[model samples]
Target: MMGTIQNRDKFLNQIASRFNRPRISSPIGKPNWKSQPQYEVYKGATQDELLEILKEQCKKIHTNFVTTDLKDLPVVVNDVVIDFGGGPIVTWKDERFSQWGLDSLMKQEWPEQNIDVFEWDYTVGNENIHKAEHANVGITISEITLAESGTVVLLSDQDKGRTVSFLPATSIMLIPKSTIVPRMTQAAVKLREIHQRTGHVASCINFITGPSNSADIELNLVVGVHGPVKVTYIVINDL
Candidate 1:
């Protein structure tokens, strides 16, 4: 849940009293930096250009990248599921799936194909995690796409469980072209804007770069040791 300090002033006042200084409750203005290089990378690049950068980064990260329009998203997603050894799939309970014409694909069509589909339900609690653990694939949509690092940001909420992206053997992230940004700098600014406007942001903001990789064991690079073994990103061009 989105939350704020219940007794912020009281808590700070107690700390100030111990320090022997008066509490300064007013907000401080941000200092101007001498150099703001964060905005310089891929500056002024169009969405298409950003997509190209993301594609290149995907190769380096060992992530499969595919581009499609809204018209073919369902087909592309279905194909990816099949390619990854068709589910038993788990996905967040996000409305966009229905909004983008994927409701039937998840709810009806996949089941018809004898593919078990599980949507995270907060009311069901731990059952969600169990389903994700056993699912062949987990699918989710990106809230923010980093073109430079080929990362996708996921904001956790009641309906969007983190396990949907973490537990499954294969993971699929749906990216809308419009959500693609140059890098982390742009993504951070967007997040700040959201917090400034709403006074709160998601409790957990995940910056997932491809799938989980680790070299902790004898310096040999291993993939999917801690997360999904295979990762595929489907970028919707006309979303």
Candidate 2:
């Protein structure tokens, strides 16, 4: 078993003695900055402006961006799945799928169209990983989106597997317009709020920017070296 640090305060006190200062055990608050430039970008901008910024950034990142209302989300998702070469598809077993009216698409429509869909089930253990590894496409919802970078943030939980984003050849990320933020600074602030309120946070948080691309191999840019070759961001406007 892992051991706990029983002498944490003692150790710190000793270090403080060496430095000729008293040990500070209190939790330190965030420093007040002279100029909070981080909030300057897209400041006072509406959600629509942020969405526009995200769209422009998507073009540079080579991510396919689509905008649709909640009413048409299922249809848009279906078209994306078919465009990405219909299943075997993998997705998180999230209630939001049903909340967003995607129950029919995942449960009935896909199967009826002869496409294999797999939802990440924690009870089955590694079987989820096996299925994700072979899936043609994986779908997930972005918990928070960074407009400046076109980044989708995913927080992993029991039903949400991280592999669903990286293991597949193609990934489809559902973005609710309400989740869009100006930049990472806003995203970090939101995460801190969650931890402060709940005293807990997701074990893993993934910030995916388009598909994987690397230039490590002889300096030649290669896509899909470490993750999906294609990435699509479906933004739900009416959500």
Candidate 3:
């Protein structure tokens, strides 16, 4: 902070002098990467097969996977709710979930306990919803699921807060089976295309594979140590 304009120039000059170089007065251009990849990242399966692979990989990593038709989403939600134990349920606002007819499903005859479901609309334009971080279950919509890694891609915006996936004890992701890609490379390429075509860049794009965990505590595995203890994926085939 104490350095002046002259001092900054002097420091650069000192380094240039040490290297026996001189400063050039010219504008620098951006670095150019290769136009094509040297080797391809193989996407070796069809959508159906990729979905199967994603489910298998998820099981191997201790992440739960559930396949249900759009009509049965509510039933699956209830099952997840039961296992999540009970605090509160937070879900997306008027997003694709509503488009796929999941509005009534969220409220379809659950236990008569005090558990409440907080749809994203409740917080719109100043709804003052509190204890959001304490919600037991957090549900989100993911457009892409990489089969090779069993990861779900979430594009964050004003409506889709990043906290929805990271703050709760259990996180549930709803992914359309049609969007299941065989590899991460295909997903990345699509994201890049979207950015280029629309000139719109999301603040955060999260690739979630499973629950937040760590094994650094004496090499002993710990779940939810960093964030949610459990992660579940509900892949919709009929969506």
Candidate 4:
């Protein structure tokens, strides 16, 4: 009996070894991923150098750059409903949004300004989340960072709803510069790991480089047509 068992194990091992193939080696082609001037140029920058590069890239994108501090955002979002889809560390829960709920933040910031903020569960695609797109702006959280390319990844997870990031005329995202990665492959690997464990794929994962812009009309160059005319990325440093 022992001999037979040993033989069976040996046979299985031999079969495994004979048929086992090395992992597939697929090569990504040029233009295989998103392209950006910022990433291409700063291929090998140290942490300190990266910070300077990020600041420069950010300044280029945002004509009016603002710090990650919440106090600074209200001034920029002058007349829009900010959907503070949580997961961002907020020091001032004292705000009306946190006090009465997200709905009240708009009411508090600018009484006349029409604002609608709410928290949604990401596991299930809630219908309310879709409404944010109709508004002039939509705000959400970020998942990955791209230091080289100056890009941010938005995972449609529970803490941060996906609709809040896409459906609005302007999509404002909060990303910490520290999370920035050099390449898209690194970002994809991180996302895959999250999906594998969570067993849920974000409805949409957006890689927003800057504002929604297109030069389609006779090459005239127009912005904010298909999506938010503006994409305000708030990079928090301290938090």
TM-scores of all models?
0.88, 0.92, 0.77, 0.57
Model 2, runs deviating above 4 Å: 1-3, 17-22, 25-30, 196-199
Q: Cα lDDT of all candidates, in order?
A: 0.92, 0.93, 0.77, 0.55
Write the residue-wise lDDT of candidate 4 on 110-131 in tens digits. 4444334444544545554555
Tens-place lDDT digits, model 3, residues 176-195 = 89888867778887799879
lDDT of 3: 0.77
lDDT minimum window of 10 residues, candidate 2: 220-229
Cα RMSD to native, each candidate? 3.3, 2.0, 4.9, 10.1
Candidate achieving the largest lDDT: 2
**Which of candidates 3 and 4 reaches a greater lDDT?**
3
Q: How many residue pairs clash in each candidate at the backbone level?
A: 0, 0, 0, 9
Model 1 off-target regions past 4 Å?
A: 1-29, 197-199
| Candidate 1, 66-94: lDDT as tens digits | 99988888999999999999999999998
- Candidate 3 stretches greater than 4 Å from native: 1-42, 107-113, 121-129
lDDT of 1 at 144: 91
Query: For residue 11, what is the lDDT in candidate 2?
Result: 88
233, model 3: CA deviation in Å?
A: 0.7
Name the lDDT value of residue 228 in candidate 4: 57
- The superposed Cα distance between candidate 4 and the true structure at residue 111, in angstroms, equals 6.7
lDDT of 4: 0.55
